[model samples]
Target: MYVIHLRYTGALAEIDDALDAHRLYLEQQFDAGAFIIAGPKIPCDGGIILAATMDRDRLDAIIAKDPFSQQRLVHYDIIEFNATRLAPGLNLPQSS
Candidate 1:
């Protein structure tokens, strides 16, 4: 699993301008089953994304195309972890 944290580096106006493209990018990722969960962080300063297990390089490439990234409006932090445990009925991404 991976946790993708995005911290805005530019002004909120810039972030807002890129929001639509960012959302569309997320929606496409979800459609492709790349994302498990995603949303804005508390206080709305940035965003968080939970992604399926996969190659870190691939994930990085995908994130590099995010509108925020393209516009250089945010910084990305990726954390990878093993899913050693899960709640009942919760399914995780299959390892590639």
Candidate 2:
């Protein structure tokens, strides 16, 4: 799997406009089973984490479509993970 770290860098005024588009993209990815979970960072850190498909190319494409990226509101770092364990309720897939 992969974890995407999105760090917002633009004006807060654009948040409401960008949020809906971001959520829409995430919802579509989730429905396609390519996304596991996503949410904003607490403490207003201007960041978000997204658990996404394992494929880097696919992840790149998905990130490219994010409103934050389109609007130059945020930058992202993609981290690939090898799931060795998962806690209940996290809904992560069992490692093969």
Candidate 3:
């Protein structure tokens, strides 16, 4: 699994301007089943994304396609880990 942390580096105005394209990019990832879940940070300063198990290079390519990355409005910190457990009835990949 992967944890994608996105922190805004630009002003809110710039962030807003790029939000739509960013969302579109996110939607594409979801459609491709690369993304599991995502949302804005509680403080709205950034966002977090949970992604299914996959190659790091593929994930990096996906991130590079993000509008925020293209516009230089946000920074990404990606962490890869193995899923050790899940809630009852919940299903997700467990391998690193």
Index of the highest-TM-score prediction: 1
For candidate 3, write residues 49-71 as lDDT tens digits.
99999989989998989999999
In model 2, what lDDT does residue 14 have?
88
Model 3 bad stretches (over 4 Å): 93-96
TM-score for candidate 2, residues paired by index: 0.82
Estimated TM-score for each candidate: 0.95, 0.82, 0.94
Weakest ten-residue segment in model 1 by summed lDDT: 87-96
Candidate 3, poorest ten consecutive residues by summed lDDT: 87-96
lDDT of each residue in 1-96, candidate 2, tens digit only: 877777778888787678888888888877777777778788664665556445677777777887889898987877887776778777665322
lDDT on C-alpha atoms for all candidate structures: 0.91, 0.74, 0.91
What C-alpha lDDT does candidate 1 achieve relative to the native structure?
Answer: 0.91
Clashing pairs for predicted structure model 2, backbone only: none
Clashing pairs in 1: none
Model 1 has a clash total of 0
Q: TM-score ranking from best to worst?
A: 1, 3, 2
